[model samples]
Target: MDPLPFLLQPPVFYPIIPYACTIFGGLRPGRMILIQGSAGISATRFQIDFQCGCSTRPRSDIAFHFNPRFSSSDAHVICNTLRKDHWLDELKFSGAPLKKGETFVLLFLFLPDKVKVSIGGHHFLDFTYRLPLKDVDAVGLYGDVTIKELSFLSSNPLKSGSADLQKTPLSKTFPMGLSECQVIAVRGLVTANPDELTLQLKSSDSIPFKLTANFQDQTLSYNSFISQSWGQPQNVQTPFFLFYPERFFEILLLPEAGLFKLAINGTPVNDYRPLVFDLKSIEELQITGSAGLFVVQC
Candidate 1:
């Protein structure tokens, strides 16, 4: 038998928090979800849950409960599964990645054994499965959050034990390819007068490739920390990065032998030496500020 085809669902635009949206056909063994939003200035804690239903009085079972608490010095993310009428042992991760007043990209990649949570584009951590995914009929959000976008789309089969990056012809991998550049592309909207958009590739807690787009000063920088101390920042002029709010754009990055070439739309943009030579260690990609996420393809 063949794998299930990718399913595309209409995204929910800017919605009020404490929201719950139904999963059209529940969920499959392999499903991908994108939640785009920012932490409110007064946000100290927030919770996102994948539950069997939206019942209240007689609380329904929750497949995955993601709670991020920033009220204490030791901020942590608590993950748990609610079965029957009791909650399971909580998995708490210290050092929360979310800023109280900054925008973030939360990507949830569901696999057979775990649900991979990527903050921005970089991998955050993985939560082992406790409840059957097929029972998850709703995605709910509550607490101090300003949701910008929330949607689901299925495409490409994931390789076992990692985020899926199908190695095929560029044409087949990306439909919007201008000239068959087998690189990573990010298409999204921009905010006004932003600082920078950063993407970090990390293994465990170590970052290999750190790509930063500075909009306030019109500069692009690349830095790496494959070992211990951070490397010197490689900066270049990118006056084209400045833009008004909600403008559509695409950024393409091709990692050649020694250099990583970047482009805006179809035009050339910038280039820098790749700090990360070992590709397998980069498990996460982090994208923050300056831009909204359309897609992150590797």
Candidate 2:
């Protein structure tokens, strides 16, 4: 194979200041290029070392040469050498383990003097240099890694609200209880139907309070609302309030009549930005039983 090209004279300087950062240039797996010998940039020995010229090195620099074919096990990693002649004595930095077919997310947080690297929610490293790190600078990556999104978060980040939100279904059933009157709020579609819903409310007692609404007359009608005590079911359209531990239950409403806002259990959501669809239209509605069994798996 032909020898890799080299710069004639490499300077010695650091490209980053104490807190500045450069976001990765498109170095994701899709646009990854195998690196060999002194990745084009002149090596700076200190902060003030200017780029002398394109220079080649025999030992102090890293080679980006890849095998003729792709191999996950043989990819290059980021390394730091003490001297230009001691490549074998280099120190390698490993980020999170790169698994084949696994997609990764990279975030660069630039502070006044340092840069923080976050990979898949796991913090990788903080880079501090003697000079300013320019944008679109090349970092390091290897095999079996796919980049999903490369983002630069300023003081005000630009991202969807759902990016950091996660929801997990309740695994255990909750006992019967009443909700505080202050909790009910109306937003999306709410209706009266027992056949299409199963709710488990818990109070101070160990037994979960069970209530199911059956839609008989094409509308879901229920006079009973959850409270702290084993109270009497009253005839009311809105939720009545009482002190309770917390309300824990799952409801599956029809596609047309969406999720009932649990904020207060009554009038429609009005405080903040509303979602386009309160309840997603799914084929099945599922809930776990008290014993952790699939109680209502639709």
Candidate 3:
């Protein structure tokens, strides 16, 4: 039930058929692709492909091929791979939910070992990797479909190396303290029916930034604790409820000039000015909540 990452990339709206685009940063675990479109009224078939490249003469290898075919008698979904212009063993599933002239939301969540496919907010199937996921660099859509929007959501903010994957109620200290350019990225899944999730940047005697996700109220609030007491809380109602129960989320905190910028998923959510001025004094990061932590990178 993780919410789809929206507005991460410049959405491709109403693109011409047979669309193909390079996936920036390539495919990785925890990344998701969301597509919103409708099938053509007279359409017989359509396909979504994750390809190694965009080559056509030799036909670039397809890591995952998700095709839905609508026949007079049978309507099913076929998943397979294409390598060296040859099709691999096909895996077919019955009862494809897609219908002609109906708008649908398609989500592909990339995990470590398999790709989870969801259509119209419902779980469909999991496609195991026949080809390595690291090789997928592009995505394509072909045949009778009209795409309203296509978006890519990245859970990790670190670009060069692996991040520390850990559990929640985590408390880590930094001897060198924080810097102006530091970015702390936290990715996790909220527990079912979570009450509250808190993330704090703390110093020896003060907390410069503390972010709280109030599930019951569906609000994101922030405040600072400098004089042994909390400041007036600033809350923002997230209409989309980014941190729903049992939903995956990614939060990024970047230290700017005089404020800290917070982004959920890939969208910038808020900027909070801190009561404490010294960035170096912020030596600890603490997270306590009802969520499973995946990646924590500073």
> Please, what is the whole-model Cα lDDT of each candidate in the order they appear?
0.68, 0.26, 0.81
- TM per candidate comes to 0.53, 0.24, 0.65
- In candidate 1, the residue pairs with backbone N, CA or C atoms under 3 Å apart (3 or more residues apart, or in different chains) clash, namely 6-154, 121-285, 121-286, 121-287, 122-284, 122-285, 122-286, 123-284
- Candidate 1, 7-101: lDDT as tens digits: 23556667787899898888776677877788887778898999999997688899999998886454578999999879999998877678888
Clashes of 2: 58
Sort by TM-score, best first: what order? 3, 1, 2
Give the winner by TM-score.
3
Off by over 4 Å in 2: 1-91, 134-146, 155-298
Q: What overall lDDT, based on C-alpha atoms, would model 3 receive against the true structure?
A: 0.81
lDDT of 3 by residue, 224-280 (tens): 998899899998435466675645577888898899988786667768887777888
TM-score of structure candidate 3: 0.65
Comparing 1 and 2 by lDDT, which wins? Answer: 1
- Candidate 1 regions with alpha-carbon error over 4 angstroms: 1-7, 72-74, 155-298
lDDT of 2 at 79: 25
Tell me how far the alpha carbon of residue 138 in candidate 2 is from the true structure, in angstroms, after superposition. 8.1
Name the weakest run of 10 consecutive residues (lDDT summed) in model 3: 156-165
